[model samples]
Target: MNGVENNLDIKTYDIPTDSDPVHDNPIISNILLSRGIVDRKQADLGLASLSHYDTLPDIKKAVKIISLAIEHNKNILIIGDYDADGATSTSVAVMGLQRLGAKNVRWLIPARLTMGYGLNNNLLEQIYQKKPNLIITVDNGISATETCQTLSEEGIEVIITDHHLPPETLPNATAIVNPKLAENEFALSNLSGVGVMFYVLIALRAYLSEQKILTQKINLADLLSLVAIGTLADLVPMDKNNRILVHNGLLKIKNQQCPMGVLQICQIANINPADINSVDIGFKIAPNINAAGRIHQMDVAVECLISSNYETCNKKAHELKKLNNQRKITSSKMKDEAESQLIGIKKILNSHHDLFGICLYDESWHEGIIGIIAGKICEQMNLPVIIFTNSYDDNILRGSARSTHKINLKNMLDNFYQIHKDKILKYGGHAMAAGLSIKKDFLTEFSLLFNQECGKLLKNKSLKKEILTDGQLNPVNRNPIFVRNLQEVMPWGMGLAEPVFYDDFIVLSYKILQNKFTKMFIKDKNGSSTWNVIYFGGVIDTKKGDEITIVYKLSINNFYNKPDVQLIVQNYTLK
Candidate 1:
């Protein structure tokens, strides 16, 4: 274990003051001020959140495409992604159209390890087996020019709805509804894949309503809860538009009338539905849905989500729990082996570069766990990371890239693809994260090329990771009132982050409990500040009597029927 502890001057932050006139409430004001929300209306908007139903752009175009598909009685196959957003988007598109009296709609999600991501000609062939009249791709297909071209050549109409960054050349589909297609045009460019699909559904619903083909039995607002889950889970930028969708979704979850699957997930996570937020989705809901896709079939998750039957939903929830547990164990084992292999890379140990970027591949490693491992390493090492693994039966090498503030992983992947087009089989992603598949034998070549690329682009100053804090606060204010207010404003994820507070504390006592967690009792000068810090898996390098600066989120800990406030430590350093 490596432990570094020393007393150092605490770094101060430019904490927003009450006089800043940004917000009237101290808690909301502090939170908004941290994110540059200086105006009262902006704060209110952020807190209230928006909806896809309220802000569906290009409604006329979207509705026209759906109505054409319906009138033609085309076989519409909803092509989805393997993650939560994709699953929810697929569900929404299929159900929404089916509700609109379209009986021929079907759904398909490419196997992550086999066909890979996006709507491709090969995937179209798979869908063609069903002999559908039309194909609607959700959460993907923006970059699928060749696939869409093939569909068009075969006299198949394609409607693409996606939120991923589009390539320089757009696909010539029957109709395309991508918010990021052009800058400064769409107000909700930050929507998730599911959110985009939801917009299409909203337009379709409106057209059906006008035609008197459907009843008002199902309100689009009812589906916002799913949209919220997908949006928050996908980690889309929580800008104004996304915040509204998520905020309203939380309101539904809090009301406990969501699909049985969501309620079951909430119960399994022990999160109060009425109090759910973005963290709960990220830490609780999304992980389980993703685990199914990573380790098994995503269809299990999708089925669970769409099932209204309580027994089936409960069973699906339990299965997700079991798979998530297996995923946790698999990730830990793989990370250990990965680190063991990295020990020989002297450059990493010497700290020659301040930022640690990793790319490791083993045909023996399970492909499903690589992305989880990449994210875990990024969090643990505070650096951008890319984890590669090979398929046991195929020559294809696949990888998932995650990033920190220092470097943009998506841009890195994009640039690499541009230069090594011949070597890259496929690659596309958003700004902070991405996925790629390449020839297995080219692993060494890609790593060396990526290293050279980083050397040319990254500066030494960009190596160190920095933590942003809202500000310091008196320990006395860490009471129920403050915690409750924070909870009310929660469902925080991605762009709109959960607030983290920093303060100096003297370690009164410390111990490694359960051989995993590091528990510390700490207080500030004059004993005015006191708190208990629990760091999960923090036992590796910690000791008693250490003065430290800690960054943490406030959470209520209920164990053994005792209720108390707990600090979920994000990072810490010697004071």
Candidate 2:
């Protein structure tokens, strides 16, 4: 079962924008305004308008230390996590440091299946062997309090650039540039791992330029493509500041001025560079990049992004494609198993015990992929979910959580940690998602407590998921040209969502794709015009000549060079 609620509601947004309508089409203007676009200034997503480096906490100190490392020719090793954000952050750090003349720079990313998440003992042992004079961490190290202390004892100075929520006791690093730090500006709040690294690189570049220490000048905008991919992949908020970063990055990527690896991945994913958007990265490129970390080691993915060789990126992209295929197969198997378990768990819900939080565990599951499964299940249940699998160690279990709007997951986890501090090995994440490790023996008790805590917070909240839409589409604005124009003002994601419109239609004909997705020929009931619609989930159970209403977004069909506009379904109702 798809688990999508057919009882959808259409809520037209009337939130006003500060300025006049920007787009020629009124529907487009209304859609933009609903997202609370303030003025033309926000619409102009140029690099000059990017937040200054000085705004980040410890920027000056971080730059000074990195500068000294470059000037003194000290060996510097970049420690990175094992996700897309981590891989891209490492790429930016390595490439930026090398460009700034740090000759002895190298990177060591943790292996997901073996080394666990961040700066654990396994990673620390490897770092110690490297014997680097300086260390820089990206996408991680915010919660590595004890690990950072160990590195300090080893006489290695660390500069941390991360964006995760910081722990109560911060890591003992020379400088921490996490935007989530209390001292940072609000503009930095939505910065992803790569975004933080980009700010650091810019700050270091500025310092070098001020000191007249650099002979060759380079524009850092070339790196925004990586920043965009990583930021979107991490699913960070798309606030105005983040929009500027992503918008500029898309410009560079579409213009073919980005790293060869990005273009190569796009080509392999069958994405046309001339017409790429945030959706392409979300659906096509990011998954392949993430697959390297989930199915294999991320070092190769990092190598692909940092390497300038055409043949190297080509080979790496193909390898990532293969990994992505494996990831899909494994993910499908896990998802099926999780769903089967959910069916059994629903019996408890039917017994009048409301399920506020869900905990699913399987020893045979792949730990690297639990987060994705948790997210999907959370969506299906409209509640908080934590999916756990057996860790590399025999006695431990690793869990990844995804939460609904009803509960603040980080706060709930913090409270749980406070009560059971000795039970959790490591736990840190944001409001929407988190990861943790614990003894496999505590699974039953932890699941009960988790459900209880979530029940407290979500007692008054409904478990049903809402499908919010941007009203109905005007017939005049439902053409290929207007849809193409809508694609221009993009980088839509969390905080700022893509527009969905609802309309009544007659299902003229329908065919099931792979017995899952439905491709239908729909005709506007108010007019004589007909259009193509692709319902993404399993079959909508509609047949020929059925009168129905469809909720959808206008999307471009990239079947060939000349793309056509089609409706991508979000929801539907039969009359």
Residue 178: error of model 2 in Å? 2.2
Question: Cα lDDT of model 1 overall?
Answer: 0.74
Among these predictions, the greatest lDDT belongs to 2
lDDT of 2: 0.86
Error of 1 at 114 (Å): 1.6
User: In candidate 1, which residue ranges exceed 4 Å CA deviation?
Assistant: 1-23, 45-58, 68-74, 183-185, 215-217, 347-356, 392-396, 410-425, 439-441, 452-462, 511-516, 528-530, 560-562
Q: Across residues 1-575, which tens digit of lDDT does each residue of candidate 1 receive?
A: 12442222234345456547664467567677666566665555442344444344455676776787787776778888888898888877876787776778888888876776769866866877988667888888898998888888888888888887777898988878888775675567787888888777766777777877666755666577788889988887777777777778788888976667888888877887876767778888888888888888788787787788999988998898888889888887887777666665534445554324667776677788888778767776555667888753477788888876667777888777888888788776665677888988788888767655656666554454566677787788787667777766645777667888877777888878756568888787456567777987446365566677777888876677565778887777774
Model 2, residue 240: distance off in Å is 2.2
Assess every candidate by TM-score: 0.89, 0.94
User: Which 10 consecutive positions of candidate 1 have the poorest summed lDDT?
Assistant: 1-10
Model 2, span 59-146: residue lDDT tens:
9999999999999999999988888899999999998898888999989998888787767677877887888999999999888888
Which pairs clash in model 2?
Answer: none
Q: Identify the runs in model 2 with alpha carbons over 4 angstroms from their true place.
A: 17-19, 182-184, 347-351, 418-425, 448-457
C-alpha RMSD between model 1 and the true structure: 3.3
> What's the C-alpha lDDT at position 65 in model 1?
69
